[model samples]
Target: MAVLGLQVVFSLVMFTFLHKLAPYFSVGRWLLSKRLSRYLHPTNDELKQLSSGNQPGKTTGQTSKAKRRAEQRRNAASAQADKSESFTVPRNLPIQLDQALVEDIDLVPLQFYSEYTWLMDFSLCSLVIYVLTEIYFIITPHRLEFNLSILWCLLAVAFCVRVLASQAWIYLRTQEGGERILLVTFTFFFLVFAMGVLIVGDNVIEFGIEEGYKNFSTSATKFLEQQGMTSHGPVSFLTFKISLAFFGMLVGTLLTFPGLRLAKLHVDTLKYSQDRKITQLLLQINYLLPLLLILLWVKPVGRDLLCGKTFSKVKPVFYEDQFEGFRLLLVVVMCGLRILLMPKFMQAHLNLAHEKIESIKKESGRITNIELQKTIARVFFYLCVVAIQYVAPVLLILFLTFLLKTLGGLSWVSLFGETAVSFFTPTSKPGMKLPKLGGENSTLGTIMDSAAEFTSTLGDIRGIFTPVWYRGILNFFLWWVLTVWFSSTSLGVMYYSQNL
Candidate 1:
């Protein structure tokens, strides 16, 4: 009560002082005029009448009508001014900063940059790549552990230096632009954003790793141990592989949305005509190359850490699963070249894009849709050939899925100079049997036929990857569902692992 009374007394004293000082302070008088004018504003006629000091008999209705018309005119002018303001985001902001970094750079393919700029790019890419490696540790049956090894110390020191380099680069760049105050602010905010994103990823990955460890340590691996079939490699490899595939795709999808958003901004904002291929290639190098390297380097055992059970065992064993985590990671990433790249194909739709998607799109009459399709196909084929290391044929299914999505039902078959089989029904109510390729009794041809039928049902990867046909936000939500499902499974595994 005493504090409340003192507050009221302080407020009264301040109000009295402000009232007395209104005439002396320009700011105070302006504020007072604003507050008082709201209820006292007069129309032109009233102002003229006041100036003339004339009293002409007029109905209250006439004065009210004049006031209404004046208010309407003022409101219309305000709305017109508001409409003229552009919706463009400020340049060099954390969310939009990557645009400025590339806007002024040239697109000469394979050209190198200056030492400091290269150093800056390296540092920025390292932060992103480390985030990816951290993710691999979580879902690949390996929990990150600090080691006393000297190599570990070197790597740790390098990472610390990288962080400092990113800060210095931002500061120096802002300094060059003559925004001295923005140097500290941009560096600080961007660091916070980077750390926040990595931390969220870490928590998600850590939770899954910890839970999976619990699950197999007790019941699943325990059951296999009783049967004397306990090999964490294959024992929990399937679960781990599925989790990695889902998580990798999930991360890839998330990266695509923001990646394309930034790329779209570049397409929209840059004053010069950009070389589409080189621009996109540079983007992939800066934002995506590290993640790709981490995915490719991942092996069930040799490259990655041991399983939770294996790591926690009395003596740890280091052997990888045959075609589990790494292979799936490869496929999940490989199929997403288009998925990770919508802004590259941002159409020339004027309503959706405030600026042209790319001036290059309009520059050439020879850059046909067929050429675009072929370009996509050529890259995908090479990527598959490189990443599909073991049981390399498994990627065939993923590739087939991609084809089905991009090319309509029978159109893909036509590309190979082959015909698609349709309704192979028997004349007399008996169904047609798939014939053997090797021999009458051989199972391989029938298995091939069955696989084809199954793959046909997997639906469209093309429709989802294409910017014109895709719903990016919806695709992201589906990946989120996968995260939730697998995350829950890990928790269940942990719960039972504890009890058993």
Candidate 2:
């Protein structure tokens, strides 16, 4: 508000002054040019006399004075041009370099931003696959139990993506100028989506450990006991899916490390705040924060505090409980390390932005050069707007998935209380024992047990997918509309770029 007020006041003052002087501006310019020309050059006849050496010594003096004034006028014109360009220069992408005055940009941060942005878009597309696969399981929980169903779906998605990319390329060839950026953004979006869906679905492992009471006794033991081992325990590792998912997620984290610099940069202002209201900052945070939060705190804490149930000892996502009651100590340490390096990224981004601005300023000494540089910046800015909005829907989905697991899991624990623990946690006592069921009833027991497993499996399937889609799809569409609207402005700018 304060900034807006100052701008309004400044504008009113400048316009009022300009309006009062409107009558005199042209007359003053003409008078000034005429007075300067007297010093700059004599009349044409006087120049002829000087060139013919008709006035001898007087002509030499006049000619030397004329030469000095001409040089001064040229210098003044150059300085005025510099002054005008400073105010009129466009504030967008400045990729051009001046041949005479150009310097190499050492802190090349924009390329990293480009790559990081692409990776994020790609990762969001990957998340859609996860959500879609989960949705399939929810709708037909009884069927599609076989892994091959999902595998085929992934394969189909990849093929479809390839077709779409080719079509997009053909369509892009039909367009030119800034409009092409819109096509490029969507083409790459689909391409990233395909990669996300295909890259990690091939390798899958279905692992289970059976637990039941035996010998007409209440004591529970694992059916798949370790070979020749006396001790009975639940599976000591995470589901293979979670394990591989964690790995893919970590690599994604590495890809987005550079973007976190925005968190620390411009912290004193609202420019790059950590608030949910700031959509650009939110989008960036949503891209990386959820997986990070899960990796750091949610999974580890849930495992320990949820109940006696815990994450498998093998490849535990968080550190051991040895951190003075903070099981997420290692996660905290790792995230802190990532934070520590952010200032370097911020510095790099700042250096690159400043360098681009300086390069444009240095090159903007002529009207043509000034217009050219400003046009480049304007187009670049428009393209960036398109890029930011293009990936918004996908990123929102990814963050929604993260929020579901973290919040839903916590809510389930709270709502069910101890019953939830008892239900999910396996029988506490573990030992191999004999069943005392009579032969006649043995078959009945077997059927009943099978029925129980089916019920449990169905429940697990719902648990896996429903929360992801519950509000996810609806919210995505709502935000998707807003993004399209925001990106439409870029489309207009793209159209305007040609005239620029």
Candidate 3:
């Protein structure tokens, strides 16, 4: 069967064209460039002038040269004394920063802006291709030999993980701030937690990994035998579970800061948007939805309770199939909600400058002009970094769900009145030969056949990379990732309420 399908073509276009177009037309850049209320940083000279009782908007007789000489004298005296001395401005001085728009063109040079823009643009393109693929399947008679949208999704997931790892790396490399120690501690904790959870019987957690793997192994063995192939089935069960735990550790590490940042954004958004009751309500919902998603997979809490005996006596509220579809749908909706409220979150992050100024106003000690300026300017400087942290994890879960739906052979059509599309049986017309590369005797055709043969051989030996195999693996990781996100976010919220 030819693997080069319409979806594959779309993937190729996305890979090639999007990189060029992203700089000029990117959702990340658009989101960041939106007109926002920002506080300007006070210059060192301005701070000194204010300290010297020079009110804003009033011209003093002092020349720029005079100010420089005065600053130089103060610096020399402080240097000789081996200590610093600086003038202090009034704590409650009425200082209003000049408001400015975060121009789209200015974002090109900001740290992480390019990375954020590319990730967002690629993810968006991949999503469009995925929807088109779903639509293509609906009207076409041919069954997909392989969903190439999975490749796009896999790449999206990879990029998201890389962004997350890079973000985490920043903390690990820090010499001070206790951030490295804190991250290491959390990674170790999550690792221990992941290992501990693996021991729990399927009855309690109901991850179904064990059952899924057994089913996969049996299917792979039979399929290989029929193909004149010999092999032990997939990796050992113990090895599989151990690998999952280690992956959980990595996820835990990557998510640590994002979760913490999420909590901070949530609190700040809620604080600032108090006047807009609707926005506040949405903020609360966005913050809490992950917890709801986490609970849905637990058999005792989610499945047994809602779809339990009481509801099952007459008829189940959700059939087994419908329930699974609902879980996928929920993740999609949650991700959408976050994206929708992105402006509010970004604005809240931007307002950190104002908030810092307010915080400094409450302090009694003198602050240097450089310190004050950085306290305000740093927020704008790293706006894109904050944005990357905010969006990476959300995209991670969203694309992962896309992969789950395609690779697990689940259907979106099922949610909208039709039965789920099952990929288990061939949907193409009977006896139709799947397309081959070029002519049978051509070099391209031979190379394609060789490649296909190699792929088959690899699958036969490594346990068939079947939909069922992916279903089980994706199902567990999807649930685990959700649990980790909610856990970390919950901890962050507590830390803010208690400590911050």
lDDT of 1 by residue, 1-500 (tens): 34233323433543454456533443211211222111111223332343355543433445576654454233223334444332221121111000101112111111121222332233223323333433332333322222112122234334333433443444456635644453344334433433332234323332233333343344444445655774553335445445444544433322222232333323332222255666556544433432443332233322344333425553423223322233334434543443233223222111121122232234434333223222322322222111111111112223322322222111122222222211211123343465657654569866787786665433222222233212222222223323322233233334434543
Stretches of model 3 off by over 4 angstroms after superposition: 1-3, 58-94, 219-235, 308-314, 417-426, 433-463
TM-score per candidate, chains pooled: 0.19, 0.25, 0.84
**What digit string (tens of lDDT, one per residue) describes model 3 on residues 1-500?**
25656777777777677867865688887777755655566544566667777865632456476653343233223334433444556665556565456767556666887789889998899898888877777666776356677788899999999988988999999998998998999899999999998888777777777878888889877886878889887689999889989999999999888888888888888888879989888988898888898888777777676666445565556656667778889999999999999888988998988878888888776666555665776787788888888899889899889988887778765544343445422377675454775998999999988987897776665455667777878877887788888788888888887755
| lDDT value, candidate 1, whole model | 0.31
Q: Which of the two candidates, 1 or 2, achieves a greater TM-score against the reference?
A: 2
lDDT tens per residue, model 2, 1-500: 34233323433543454456533432212211222111111122322343354542222345576564444343223334453543222223222221111111111122233432333333333444444534443444233133222332333334323332433344457655643564445434433532343232212100011111111011212222312435443333234224433433322222121122232232322233435365445444433443443322233344443333363444533233222123222223333343333332333223333344555556634334344433333322222222222233223333433333332222222233455434543343443344645454588777766776886656554543432333332222222222332233334434434433
Give Cα-based local distance difference scores for all models.
0.31, 0.33, 0.77
Task: Show the lowest summed lDDT stretch of 10 residues, model 1.
Answer: 93-102
Clashing pairs in 3: none
Error of 2 at 83 (Å): 23
Clashes of each: 1, 4, 0
Query: How well does candidate 2 match the true structure in TM-score terms?
Result: 0.25
Candidate 2 achieves a global lDDT of: 0.33
